[model samples]
Target: MCSGADEKGGEQVAGRAGGMAALPAGLAAAPGNAAEARARYFNSANAFNIHLDPVPAHIFTAPAAAALGPEGAVTGYFLCDQSARLGCPWPATTPFMLARYARIAPGARLAADFAASGSIWYVIAGKGRVYGAGAGAGAGAGAGAGAGAGAGAGAGAGAGAGADAGVAEESALAWSRGDVFYLPAGASMLHADGPDAAVLWLVTDEPLLAYHGLRSARPDDAAVHFKAGDIAAEIERIHRSVPDAGTSGLAVVFSSEAMQARRNLMPALTLSLNTLPPGCAQSPHRHNSAALTLIVAGADCHSRVDGETCAWSDWATLVTPAGAPHSHHNEGPRRADFLIVQDGGLYYEARTMGFEFLGG
Candidate 1:
């Protein structure tokens, strides 16, 4: 049968075998037996151009507020779930990553047992320590926390890199506000808050792994920590070295020795600390990878995502859907800081990370 158009202008499949008209007439076959009944096929017109709901560019404020609430707030996770909007069965922020905020009351400990290949975390407030096989005995900012922690601990333990010889070889890594950390698969961790309540923003590629019906293989690397003080010093150095124009925003990318070659937090995720100087705005740009950002210090700042203004709130989790033209503006007196986790490494490895700066 010749291919033709239906009333809706969609290509018409020619055959109808037992009401199964999805395939071309030539390929359509009525189920002969139980084995053949299980088979299904579709032509170029219908099966090849599948479209799932586009992930929404959204901001989650209520969850952030709850996590950053008073000291008595319960210790739990406030997930920024968009599964309903994205038509995904599992909880997800973007299609690939799951973003959430965790609040731990003073001296309380919460165990995180996620089934992701890797997890990225940022401390929004208070102080804490992590205990787990993945938490290196002592590690600091701008240093490798995986296998390097064991090999280089002696030489690098000083000042910001506090020496913790008493800490078990498989537990206890101290952290504070502005700190960022990454843990490999199967690294179940216990987060213990200090004297004050703690709020942390976390993102992981659990949805991606779930979608693929795969589980992460047992991982052996320890957690890598980027201390607050070290990150501050690095940001200062970057601000001094960066030019006013002709460069990307002064962002700090976090990486460990195991991932240094790729300069990413994990095989499928990329983490960065992005900053917008006072009265400055990032040039409008777009990329294929979706971004899950934690607004850390945006007093009077907002983002223009695909022509829609998304006002910023402290510690809020913002989602920039893939391929949305967006720009960050800081109208306040101080600089705005945000930590962004993107599934860019997956695209980068696939050679499909289409990053582009839009022309005004």
Candidate 2:
């Protein structure tokens, strides 16, 4: 699908390589070699569609502690909350963002504080124990192996107050590959290394208030709550629903426990798993609200934002800003699976108020 050229209707570039030629004048300078200059031109011209092919060689097996890019930045990776500095109070209490790739040794325990603006936890590799409130724990509710004892001490209080507190405190949830976990504001939680060592992509809006500071507020018990089984089971369910579902495209409103739990945390967040059939193209479309997409399976699938195109491999995350036009296409020969997170409530509200999706 090609769009006509500029307002003058002159011939415009088409495809990734050709698109690079149309970069804005006077913005072609780059810091390094010829290739870097080309990349810079491409990035400036089509920041949205800049694609990296063959995936970088050192990304997957590289150590978490190793530097991925320039100082204060991870090359080829985008961290959402880029302003946060380690060990400092969050610049803004409203919605600070921070992301880290942490590797935990097998059987080790890692504790973290809950955020003032809330948090989302995604497992990139390995497994681990996540501690938080049980189903009924409320804000300020005490938890631990001694939860029963702690509850008994407050049993004499009004039923409603105790129940409310319990619900608030039960914030931590279990997660694994393709699982996106959320902790509501004011909740304190922790995680322990799973049987095998684990690597986690931890994200939050508030980076200053850590788990240690909230230890006094933590319950004594640890909990493991949710788990998503093997891919075979998931694929089977999808196949059952759409017997002829061999083509690449997104399937929205599919049901799953993980999807339900995510919806509970943010009622507006829409959850879905998409399968992109090899060689299929998803033409450009825009969402009126912010969205987060994670590749769960397959590799070498490319996406274009505005006009930049890049191949995003499994476990890679792609963030689409609200109202930004974007599109995805399968560049590899295998099926690609992705988890899409979007603000469903916002979309509905925008549509009710008359927003339109422009197909490119």
Give the candidate number with the greatest lDDT: 1
Clashing pairs in 1: 134-223
- Lowest lDDT sum, 10 consecutive residues, model 2, at 146-155
Candidate 2 per-residue C-alpha lDDT over 218-299 given as tens digits, one digit per residue, 9 for 90 to 100: 2332222334564446665676675443333455333334335434233334445677778877756665554556666766
User: How big is the positional error of residue 243 in model 2, measured in Å on the Cα after superposition?
Assistant: 10
State TM-scores per candidate: 0.82, 0.52
**Candidate 2: C-alpha lDDT:** 0.44
Model 1 residue runs over 4 Å out of place are 1-37, 137-170, 244-246
Best by TM-score: 1
Deviating ranges (above 4 Å) for candidate 2:
1-79, 83-102, 116-118, 135-180, 186-189, 202-226, 230-235, 242-248, 252-265, 347-357
1-360 in candidate 1: lDDT tens per residue?
245535564645343232333544343277778877767667555666678998888999988887777767777677898889999888888889998877777765555556688688888888877655467644222221231111111212111222233456445677888888886665343445568888788888888888998867755566888998899998999988946665768998999988999999899999999988899989999999999988889889999998999999878889999999999999999999999899999999999999988976
Clashes of each: 1, 27
Against the reference, the lDDT scores of all candidates come to 0.76, 0.44
